[model samples]
Target chain A: MKIITVKKIENAVAQLAREANLFLRKDVLTALKKSYRLEKNKRSKLFLKAIIDNAVYARKEKLAICQDTGLPLVFIELGQDVRILGDFKQAVIKGIALGYRKGNFRESIVSDPLLRGKPVYQGAVIHMDIVKGSKIKITVMPKGFGCENKSQLKMFLPTVGIGEIKKFIIEAVKTAGPDACPPYVVGVGIGGTADYASLLAKKALLKRIKLQRGLSPACPPKQQWREGTVSGLERELLLQINKLNIGPMGLGGKTTALAVNIEAYPTHIAGLPVAVNISCHALRSATAVL
Target chain B: MPYAAQQQYCRDCPSDGKIMKILNAPIQEKYIRELKAGDEVTLSGTIYTVRDQAHKRLIQDIGRGKELPFDTKGAVIYYCGPAKAPKGRVIGSCGPTTSSRMDEFTPLLLKKELKAMIGKGRRSKEVIAAIKKYKAVYFLAPAGCGALISKYIKKAETVAYPDLGPEQILKLEVKGFPLIVGIDSQGGSIYDKD
Candidate 1:
């Protein structure tokens, strides 16, 4: 069994925060490049180029891809076989503090939702899960409020048809419009408890766009989407979303969405819940396993 | 689904397409009226910064009949709350935030003779109508490309509500600050382009 120090988690988080903000993930990069090559509207093409160039400059200059380096959404997959150390929660918080200061990432969090005082990026949105491995894995998704504000969850009767889900997803993306920095990567979560469904949606975003052939058929469907296969509903939703043509900035175009990723969980017999999590083109994310 | 692609507005556009004519703030209505949606331009001169919190305070100040920290006439308000500069940089990644978040305050600000706005995302109908009524324009600063933008800024100083931290009002001296006309004096919106 691995004896990973709490200090290691702290240090990993600090570096993850900086790296997440500064770098664009490869999956997103590939999608954007493909979109840029295929983009017809000259205006949309120019927008795509700027997105590409901005990534380049961000890497070269060692600056955040966006001013809103965002409140950290820290996901920790702790190994059940690994031995842990000090106060884990405090270590995560302190690491965020160190990262915000050292990385010069913006503190976008407010003191309270209603009170709205000074920024409080010192704290993080930490999600922990226990896994079978001997090493801990950490992922940092810097979530800017602009897109997060647009995410939504809808609870439907178990009798709800896929058509209703499609409509809800379309409405969500349309309502987001230019506001979510169009040409978004939409994460869809279906069939879980309300809160858990939204979590599933966000988790779905961590998976790369399903540009490769549908999920591998040889692999068994172990829940948590280890198989990478797209259900019929997921494929249909992706097709319909791109048809919205909300385009790059909602200024309009064909490339309204880069990709749609869906994850599902078992739900109560009477409930059907759907959640959508939208991420802008900056899609700043990074992960590390120790 | 068969689809014919619709066009989105261009911001952070090509430097080669049109020779950018610069506008210095305290912008003139005539200059604003001459602008139309989709035209790219670079702004130079002084611009005032405000975000949701500062905008609320400024509106409150107006209602209270107290003086605003900066004059509203012929003014351009930039919707941003920039990160502090690292060593040797004039400003940090200073890109625009979503403009629609300030929609409620915008029409009121425009009524006070605010001439223009610079931010990303679309504005509300009330704000667009006010831009028309006031003969002003709305410009879209590219979203998420702040570091490249900081180079255009020559100076930045906190001008009001320092207590708000990043939400503090800033008076920035900028040079060739690129933007696209997202909405024009006639209420023509770039978001509506085909």
Candidate 2:
């Protein structure tokens, strides 16, 4: 059995938080650049340029990319054969608090939802999964509220077709319009229970966007999931969403969305649950494994 | 320098033959009246920043008839709550937040002669009506461009509500701050047209 210490986890989470806030992921950057190249609207091109430049400056200056450093969400994949040495939850909360303080990231979390007290950097939304091997992987995504507020969930009758699901996803993006800062990276979760679907949608945002048509990393070499499976659906949705003309900041352009990432799981025979989670251009997350 | 003479030939201006205008804050109504929706402009001089909490506090103060932290007459307010500055920087990544969140408190501030608001996203119809009623303008700073926008902010100091942390009201001196006119004084909106 591999023994993992809480101190190691704490350090990793802290560094990941800081890195995620300061650096725009390369996949997101590549997608943005491609959109800039393809964008026909002059105003949208300018906005895209500014966004790209902002990422550069943020990295150079070691600054938060956007003011809303967001609520820290830590996703953990734990190996069944690994045992943690110390208080795991406390370590994560402490790590996030320490990182936010040291990195000058804005603590966007409030103590209570309704009461809404002063912002605190105490806790993070943690999602953990038990896996096969003896390794611990952590990914920190600081989800900005501007897009997170626009997330939606729908419970569809099991008899419905793909057309209805597509419409619902399209409507969610439309309702988001310019409010959530398009061109968005749209994450869709279909199947599972309601809450699980929401979680799956959020997790879908972490997928690496495929810039070209090829095998996706999520699938095995023999599977060819990119052209034959859900990835085909992703491509179709991407085309439909960009047609909405809700371009960068909803100013109207050809690139309304950079990518559509979908995750699916088995659900009850009588229900079909769908959730949409939208992410802004500065899609920031960092991952580390030990 | 002449107000309109400093035009930089903005590439992002609306396709309506409107020349990019360079204006200073404490903006006059006449200058605002000259702007049309989709016009690209750069602002210089002082502008105040306020976000959700500050808006609520400002409204409460307005309700209680207390003196405001800064003069509101003919002033341009930016809807932003900036990140805390790191060492040696004047301010951190300061950029506009979603403007619609401030809709509830905007009309009362407009009644105090708030000339303009700078933010991202669409505004409520009530706020749009209020903007037209007050002949106020709404400007759009590029969303999600905080670090780039911070370069324009030469100075930033918290002016009120220190307890609110990043949500504190900030008085910022900006130079050549880029913006696009989202809604003009005459009920013209870039959002509607485009």
Question: Which residue pairs does candidate 2 place in steric collision?
Answer: none
Candidate 2 C-alpha error for residue A7, in Å? 1.3
A1-290 in candidate 2: lDDT tens per residue?
Answer: 99999999898899999999999999999888878787888878777887888899899998899988888899999999999999999999999998888898776788888987788888789999999999998999999999999999999999998889999999999988898878899999999999999999999999998776332212233333465368777877787788888889778887788888999999999999999999988888999998
Please list the C-alpha lDDT of all candidates, in the order they appear.
0.81, 0.87
Determine which window of 10 residues in candidate 2 chain A has minimal summed lDDT. A213-222
Candidate 1 wrongly placed segments (more than 4 Å): A212-231, B1-12
Model 1, range A1-290, lDDT digits (tens) per residue?
A: 88878899889888888888888888788778878777777777777777888888878887778888887899999899999788888888888888878877677878687998888667788899999979889998998878988999999999987678889988998888887677888888988799999999999888876454332211123343422345555655556777676788765667888877778888999999999998888887889998
Residue-by-residue lDDT tens digits, candidate 1, B18-54: 4665677878887788788987777878898899999
Considering every candidate listed, which one attains the maximal DockQ? Answer: 2
Leading candidate by TM-score: 2
Give the TM-score of each candidate.
0.92, 0.94
Q: Could you give me the TM-score of model 2 versus the true structure?
A: 0.94
**Residue runs of model 2 more than 4 Å from their true location after superposition:** A213-229, B9-19
Per-residue C-alpha lDDT of model 2 across residues B1-194, encoded as one tens digit per residue:
65667676544333223456898998999888888998789888899999898999999999999999999999999988888888998888877888999998999999999999999999999899999999999999888988778888999987988888778888999987888899999888888844
**What is residue A136's positional error in candidate 1, in angstroms?**
0.7
